[model samples]
Each structure stands twice: as structure tokens, then as C-alpha cells.
Target chain A: MSGNSEMSPRRPRLAVWKLASCDGCQLTLLDCEDELLAVAGAVDIAYFREATSAAVDGPYDLSLVEGSITTAADARRIREVRAATTTLVTIGACATAGGVQALRNLGDIDDFKKAVYARPEFISTLATSTPIRDHVPVDFELRGCPISKRQLLETLSAFLARRTPNVPTESVCLECKRRGNVCVLVAHGTPCLGPVTQAGCGAICPAFHRGCYGCFGPQDTVNAPPLLTELQQLGLSPPQLERLLRTFNAEAPAFRAAAESLGAGGEK
Target chain B: MTERTIAVDYLARVEGEGALRARLDGDRVEEVELRIFEPPRFFEALLRGRSFEEAPDLTARICGICPVAYQMSASHAMESALGMHVTGTLRELRRLLYCGEWIESHSLHIYLLHAPDFLGFPDAVRMAKEFPEVVARGLSLKRAGNHLMEVLGGREIHPVNVRVGGFYRAPEREELEALRPELEKALGLAAETVRFASGLEFPDVEEDYEFVSLVHPDEYPMNEGLIRSSRGLEIPAARYEEEFEELQVPHSNALHSVRRGGGSYLVGPMARYALNRTRLLPKTRALANDVGLEPVVTNPARSIIVRSLEVHYACEEALRILSTYRRPEAAFVPPPATFEGGSGAAATEAPRGLLYHRYELSRERLIERARIVAPTSQNQKRIEDDLRHLLERQIRADDATLTDACERAIRHHDPCISCATHFLTLEVDRR
Candidate 1:
């Protein structure tokens, strides 16, 4: 590792930038506590404002940007961030697809801001929050509300090694079955989003004896029709299933159709 | 004569987006700022139409590090407005889960994040290379806290079991009893953390500011207490807005809070430590005195030591609760969300500091309006004050000295930016 970092000719400075989402995706980096020392030894963090006061000049080799571009200014900020980096990888559902805050995209942004701030006029934000790809060309996207730490480290390692990261794009239901956990829908009649949601977070909810809530965004090429049918089978009226899909990963295509099928917008 | 700006564009090992900046004009320091530029999600606006029951889950997203505190505060407010007492094992279970949060969040901050700053390192990962044993010990302690939450709340991040009135489910006695060994191991690690923090190089900067935290007569405040400040101001949680008020500044979208009289007061570890020193677990109390941590004086800079002391207390508290943990006869009390008219506020001790929630529930059981004053928000003004004070110390020092001082200043408050990210532009004009 020392020889690799030294003989790599030039250390690619990495900058972590945030947009609009839960801080969880960025937190995954720190959450990799055990592997952090090893990871730092490999990469030269040129501009990670979340972690250090010191800055090394950055025309970064790689930029791992978290969150979605939500405001008009953030829409501008992404271009500046993209210009300074060679490879731009978006991490988390927020950056790849619009995050939970995208729920505001379906509603009124001015009405939303006014409800929260005493002086809503002071806030400068866009009517919609969209993924970084809408604003700039993204090299890669590691999906999930808070991207898994192991997956993050693996992505970093792959980027450094000049190889594609070994990330699975299968549905969480596949992993849930691989772990030999019983299907809650088959046995307990509990509706689950696992069949359509991405395979990450280790199928956390199912392991905890609850159905998946799809916090990790949707899986690749998801079959949403069957799941909506399952929700109906489990006694969820159309409105209930609509509310369920419109949570954290609301704006993803598969979830959007499921919500629309039930005849509703992204509100309770 | 030279004028220079010391800027830390990012702070490492801590949660959320934070940067520290200061300007030195020759031998005089012009301005200092602690800025939170984390991306904004506008949660307050989103919650306007969400169901009252959804508040716990929705607001929990505010901080991944301290979701439990948000859930607790929101739940209590909702329950109170619904005119109900969440009595029996459910109440005890809530306390136990809070203890888990205290253990996890405290250990994570005190050892992994804040300790390295005192020891002259770039981050915890750097510090860990020299202190492997300490890092390992801290992880297991942290793991124990997450484990406790997993068992009780369903998952560590945005736990599922908690609801407005009670949990959806409860763990059996055998499952609850299984955590004893983990708690035991955590206690050992906590003791080591005390020694480790005690060994760090603490700068000789102390302040005589006011310490504000929740205090309960029966215990070191966890779920409920009378809001108290070191300046001798005490009031019920219902009167929290009256005492501590948030002001919106034109420079930033985030609100800066202060005690009603005008002076900024601190929250989190130092505040909690001073206000509830006597109520600390026995072993933790002894360790505080052992480490030479005197609860006297409100030095925001020295709060790191106090944070370490509180970690000791949290570990001890976790162990106590785990050992005596009894599954209450009932997991939770039923909700009375149909109250005609009720207004209530709730305050809970988060891993960082006091988290306050106020709600006005209408007869229909939907929320008319809600106000959430997070611990990180209350501590913002205090953090800026620390920056201003620390800059005075490094007035004669170089850019590097001022930069480190700015780091130290922000570290004093241990700002969590996900909650405060809606606002900030820290400018230190040297001219």
C-alpha cells in the first residue's frame, strides 16, 4: 500500500461535496471506523470539509459527491465541483436519484418553505430537488439513502485500482432469500418493498422482523406490478401502498409508477 | 505588518458539514466564525402536512448520530398533547434505549472524533495508528450501544420500534438479559477511554460561560427534566421557549439561540455535566474527580474533557440499566391522540445535548404546528462565541496557529451540522 501510494506517480486528491439529503451517505465514510486508517493511507483527501480544517489545493482526481442538488445555487455549485474533478462518483440515493426531499418536487416549494421558516422569504431554494446527473455528468453512482460503508470503501478501492467496483445490482429480496430469512409476505402476510428495492443495508428491516421500507432506493429493472399486487393481497388499500412507496426513495421510477397506480401524490 | 486568514473548509471525524475560519490583522484578530454548510433538506416545511404519528420517524432523519433523541422528544410531545402517560415497562424501555444512544453517541464522539483534536492529530484514524488498543476498545463500546438499539428499537439508524404511545413490539426477557456481557465489556472500555482522554494535551483555555441542560431530581436527566442553566435560570420544559429563544439572523438561514437575557449559553456535555454532576453513576462520578475534571467554570474549550467524563458516566449508566433491565409487563401504553386541546413541550438528553420539541395538537389529533429546537441549533451561537474567544488567544500567532485555534473553537461545541445545515456563511473579514 505504501509502495502503491508512493509509486502511483501522483496522488489523486479527493474532495467530498454535499448537496441536499440526510448526512448519512457522507457519514458512511466516518462509519467505516475500523477501515478509515487504511483508507486514508491510500488516498490524499484534498477537500473533505466534513472532516478536516486543513486543505490541500484541489483539482481533485476524484470527487465523491453526496446528496442531491436541491436549490438553484446548488444547481450552479455542481458544475463548479464537476470542473475541479477528473472522475465524479455520486454516492447515495440522493445523488443518483432524488432523495426523500424530492417529495417536495410533487408539492409546492414556496408553501413548504413558508411552513418551516418564520421568514420564508430569506430562504433561497429551488421548487424541485433533482439528482446531480441532471446538473452534471456523473461517472458512477453508489445507491442507497446512506450508502453502505463496505460498499463505499470497495468503490474507493476499485477506483484506485482501476477496476469496476464489485457492487451487486440485484433486488434486496434476492439477498434476503440468500440469507435464508423467511419471506414475511409469504408467512406473516406483511407487505415488503424488498422485491423492488436495491440490495444494500443488508436487508436490515427483514432481519429485524419487519418488512423492508425501501430506504436504499430501487433495484435494477425492478418488477413493481407484483409488489403492488402483494400490498393489496396483504390488505393494504390502494392509498396505503401509495403512501408506503412515497417515502425515502419516492421519486425513483418504479416507486413513482406504484404510487401513481394507486392514484395519489407524494403526501400522506 | 501582515493580515492573514486561517480557514478549515472541512472538519473531519465529526458528523455533518462544518468549517472554521478566522482572520488575523497584524497582532489583532479581526473576526472568527464556525460555519455549518451541510446541505439543507427543509424538514420543518415537509412536516407541515405529515400525520402527527409520523413526526417521530420523519424528524429522526435530522441526525443519523442522534435519531433516538429526536424520536424521544417527538414522542413525548405527541403523547403529552394526546393527554397520556407512557407508563410501565414502556417508560423503562424508553430509558434503556436512551442509555444505548448515550453510550453509542458519547463513545463515538468522545473517543473517535473529539479525542484526536486534543492529541494533535488530523483525525481519529490517524490517532488510532498510535492508539490501537484505545480505538479497538472504543469500537466495541460503540458496538454495544448500537446492539442495544438494534434489540430495542429495530435498527440503529431511524429505529422502527418506537411510536407515539408505545413500541410496535418488545424484546423478551431472555433477549434483554443477553446484553449484560456487552455492557460489561463497554464499561471496561469506557474506563480506558477516561484514561486516554485524561492523557490528551488540553490547551490552557477556559471560559466562564453559562451551562444549560436538562436536570431531573431523580436521575441525570434522560427523557425529562426542568430546563436549567448554570446562570441560575430554571423552568419547566413547557417554559423552554420563554427562557431559550431562537433568533433568525439575516446573514444565515439557521436560527441562533440564546438564553432570554442575551448571553449565549452552551448545551451538550459541559452543560449536562455541570447541571447533573451529582446524578452521575457512582463509578463515573469518581472518574470525573479522578481525571481532575472540576464542574466549576464554563470553559467551552475544556468541554472535551467533560465529554470524556460524560462518556464514562454513559457507559456506567448503560451497565446499570442493562444489569437490572426488566421487561415491563406491557411494552407500551395505548395512545390518546384524540385529546380536544393540549399544548406541551418535551426535552430529552441527546448524545450531543438537550433536544427540545414543542407541539400544538388540535382536537382532530393532527398537529396544528410544531417547533423543534435541536441541540446543535442551540449550540451554534455558543460555538461562534468560542471562535471569537479562541481567536483572541492566537492574535499574535501565524495562519497555522489560527487555523488550529479555529478547529479547537468548533470542537468545543461539537457541532452536528445535519440539523444546522439549513444556514451559515462564516466570513472573517481581515480589513
Candidate 2:
């Protein structure tokens, strides 16, 4: 793709799309400060608003979609994005699950709107914030509140190689154990989601002497029931457990089920 | 009568989704709208019923570019509500974390997002093909900032370390000292950045701005200060709502903030530098003087220089904190066991400008209500005002030229539209 010969086919066109998100996942690409120019050389950045003003008409080779489908226009836009790209990869919790904003999914969205805006009537939003996969088929989902840079690079490299990305599906516990650190849950009696949460963030919270807050969402084979039980035994109140499950990946199936089973339901 | 329209379907090189529209009637400007189409996540609404301790992490999601600003503002507000003050090493650590953010965020803007316009490139990637060393310096400088954040806060983007009252864990002196060499290199690079930015040709134009920023007595404001403005308006964070009000407009999702019973005001690098010029470190102050940068820069286009100067200040500040580093006994000062249920407010200087957060907590420590006024929301109207003036001057320019100029002007403030309704597309209608 970096060939200089005129006979070489043009580089794969990469387009980045944002729906409703903090713009973190895409920033991860830019944050690859050392590798950004190389990535650019490997792919033609057809569209990326946060980094470049230039754009090219798309039938892009690959599209990395960030954020969630939170508005009617965004819902419509994602379809257009899917239609324009050959491969669509959803980045971050917002695109893979529904993200922290999905807390509104469990509540009365009208009330949610009124709580923030003085003229709630003026705001145009869907009742629920949902991941990109819910609206359109996502080729792959890279998970995190803000995804890990290493994982992001791996995913991009995988796309260029036409191979499956080597992101781990194991829980944070495995990563924590590999780091040779004492378990905060076992040693400190802290309520931790490391046992159920996905790995990618390098088990940061635990290393910092805190329990995992599950920013990477649920692991592939989560048995959240036992973890909740353990948390309860560790002195977490029922409301606290429910609240913890209803954070960054609030609407991820596993977490939502766990929170719902606690009877709080994340709803009024 | 001739009618023409310039419409930018999507605005690029900005943090989030937004568009712009301007209408011109003959030579007079009819309207300028800095449209923010980014879907509102209803952060303030969702924050209710969440634990007070969750504020820092949750609010950090507001903008990827300036998560530290949100974290700092939320943490400080929660601390104020609980009547807990983090002193000594912990306080210095917060400033240090902020310096890392400023360095990273400012470098991102100067080199990647904003510089392309001045250098006649589409983006930094293209610019890199020709000016590899320049872009490399920027990326290296950004890496230094990110490395500092990683060592201290655990990760750069949405750091997992910051908590109310203090940090989840304080890095050892060695962990911090490891950053000194890179920071030293970054300081030199940042100085080069100021010089590089100063060489850019700015339009000889100035705006009468009511510049607002945090003013600290001892240091350049980052984590704490009185909210002061160039117009002699000084108030605590608690009085932020009294002085400024967010008004919802039909064209955009982000609310436009203006001084109460007054018009639009400016914030960010220009505001901070103008308000706290003397408070900058001696080296940074000397650099600014050497570059012949005015004490009070009123031209929005010259903000790139101010932002570069801030990057220099942040580097120096980070080194200063590192030089005197000592790990606090506790990772955090735990909140009081019992709660009386109170409210608190705080304003911190985000790389862009002042970010204000207020929270009302229940006796059970759950958040009852929350309000976040992002810098871009405050600057949105002022940005439109700047656009209006720019359009007036370039009235005879073609649609594409006017549209390009408008986007450049908006970029001048480095508006984080994600933080604003928390934001561009451009439309110019000439009739």
C-alpha cells in the first residue's frame, strides 16, 4: 500500500464516522502519535472530521464507526455509512454496547431531557441510545469506554491484513493476574468486576488499588451472578451493585441483565 | 438581487458533530449560526442518582480531547460539596495531571487540527509527507504528555485514576521521575512550537473580546482560581451562573452562553493568557516576550500562539511538580462518612477555556442534580460573533472562500462541540 509506483493500486480508503460519542475511539487513532503517519500511509484517510478537513467520496475500503445511534438522523446516517463501506468496525463501548448515555435507555427519556435542558421540547433525541450493531451489522466490535491504543492498532493492522483482530475475550482478572498484582477483591475485600469485565485497559483500576468499574464491558462468557454475590458478601449494598452494573456499559446484555435482576432495573 | 449560499454539510478537524450557517443580505450580515448537531447524551440528567464518587469518571466522557478538564472540575465540585479539601502533594498531583492534559490537548490542536489551515494542508498526515520533522516533533511532544498521564493517571484518554478528594493511587517518586527526561525534551519542543506558530501569518484583525478565565494568585490557573474576565468581572465559581447564562437556540443543540443581560464573551488560551500573563512561569513568560507576543492578544487567529505558549507553561509546570515530587501517605482523602446533603460548584481551566460543574448531593451521597457548562458552549455565541465579523470583511469573497474562512475562525477557539450541546456544517447565504 505504501508503493510509490504508479502501477500500484491506490491505498485502501479509510473513513471514520461518529454517531453520538465522546470522540475518544477515533482520537485513539490520532493518539497513535508514532504510528499515525504510517497508518495514513497504509490507508487513504477519506474522511475523519476530528483530524482533517479534507474528505473523499466514499465506497470506502474500511469504516471505523464510533459512538452509538442516539438520534433519528444518526440512525439514518449509520445505514448510509454501512452502505458506503466494505468493512465496518465499531469502536468503544458506545458503538459495541450503548455506553454510559444508555443509562437514559432504562429511564424516561422525556424526564432525562427535561432534567438537563430548559427547553426540553427543542431537543431531538431517540428514547434509547443503542450500539451500532443494533442498527446495522458491524464487522467487528472493539470494546472499551475509550478503547486501548494497543488493541486499536491491532484491529487496524488486522483490517489491513484481512485477518481477525487478536483482541482477547478473557476477563480483566486474567490480565490482572498476569500483571503479578494482588487481587483487590481477594486481598482488600473490594467489590470488583475484574472477574466479569473484559480485558483491554490493562487492569488499571485494580493496579491503582480500586475495583474494576467495567469500562470495557462484560467478558465473553460472563457469569455475573456469582460476582454479584461475592460483591454483596464484600459489603456492597444492592443499590450499589445495581449502580455499578449500570455505568459505562449499562446496556450491554450481561450488565443490564445483572442490574435488572437486582430489582432496581435502572428505570424509574 | 443575486442570491448565493455556501453550505458545509459536515465540519472536519473538530472534536464532534457540528455545522455552521451564515446569511448575508447585500453587504450586511443577517445571521451566523454555529450549529451543533452532535446528539446530546443528557449527561447532567443521567448523573442524577449516581454516586458522588462516580462524577469524575462519568463526566470525563463528555469530551475525549479534554477528559481531564471534566474530571478535575467534577472532582473539585464533589470535594467542595463534601467540605473536603485535598492539600499538599495531592493538590500538586492534580495540577500535574492537568499540565499533562494541556500539553497533550494543546499540541494536538496546534500540530494536527489547527495547523493544517495555516500551512495549506488538509491534515497533519499530509503535512507530515513534506514536513516530517515538524510533525514528528508534535507527535513526540504529544507522546510525552500522554506518557506523563499514563504514569500518573494510568491512561491518557479517560484516565481511571482521578477520584473525588484525590487520586485512586499516587505514583511513587520514581514513577514520576521517569517522566522528567521526556518532559525536558518536550519543554524544548514546546518552545520550538511557539516559534513555529509565531511564524504563521495571522490576519491583521482584532476583536473586542470580554475574555474570561480563572485567575490564580501564585500560579497560572489550572485547577483553582477566581473566575475573572478582561472586562473587570471577578467572581467565584459559585457565581458563574449569576454572571453567565446558557441560552438555547433553534439552530443548534449546544446552548450559547452569554453574560447575564450581556452579550457573548470569549474563553480559552487567549482569555487565560490575557488574564494571567504574569502568573506564567519565568521561562514561559520570557519565551512569550521573546516572540513579541502581546500581553493581551485580542486576535482570535493569534490564539494558536497563546496555546503553544501554554504548552510551554504546562511542560515547565510538570517539571516543577516532578522536581518536588513526594508520594502522599494516602491515595485519597476519603469523603466524610456522614453526609448533610449539600451543594458545591467549581470552574477549572480546560485547554479550551473555563469548564464549570455544579452538583447537589443527597444525604445518601447520591447525586440529586448536576449542571455542566462546557467551554465550547460558552464560546459558541462568541464564535458566531467572530464569524459575523469575518463575513462582513470578506463579503465579496466567493462561497467556498467565505465557508473556508468561517471554518478557520471557528477552529480559532478550538471548539469542542462534543462538550458544547455539548457541537459543524457551514452554510453561507448571500442575497
**Number of clashes in every candidate structure?**
8, 12
List TM-scores for all candidates, in order.
0.90, 0.98
Ten consecutive residues with minimal summed lDDT in candidate 1 chain B? B422-431
Instruction: Give the whole-model CA lDDT for all candidates, comma-separated.
Output: 0.75, 0.91
- Give the C-alpha miss distance for residue B80 in model 1, angstroms: 1.7
Model 2 regions more than 4 Å off: A1-8, A265-268
RMSD of each: 3.4, 1.6
lDDT of 1 by residue, A26-116 (tens): 7667656567667777777777655654567658888999888777777888899898888899998788878877888777888777776
lDDT of 1 by residue, B277-326 (tens): 88988898888788777766466656666766766676677666666666
How does residue A249 of candidate 2 score in lDDT? 96
DockQ of each: 0.45, 0.81
DockQ of 1: 0.45
TM-score of chain B of each: 0.94, 0.99
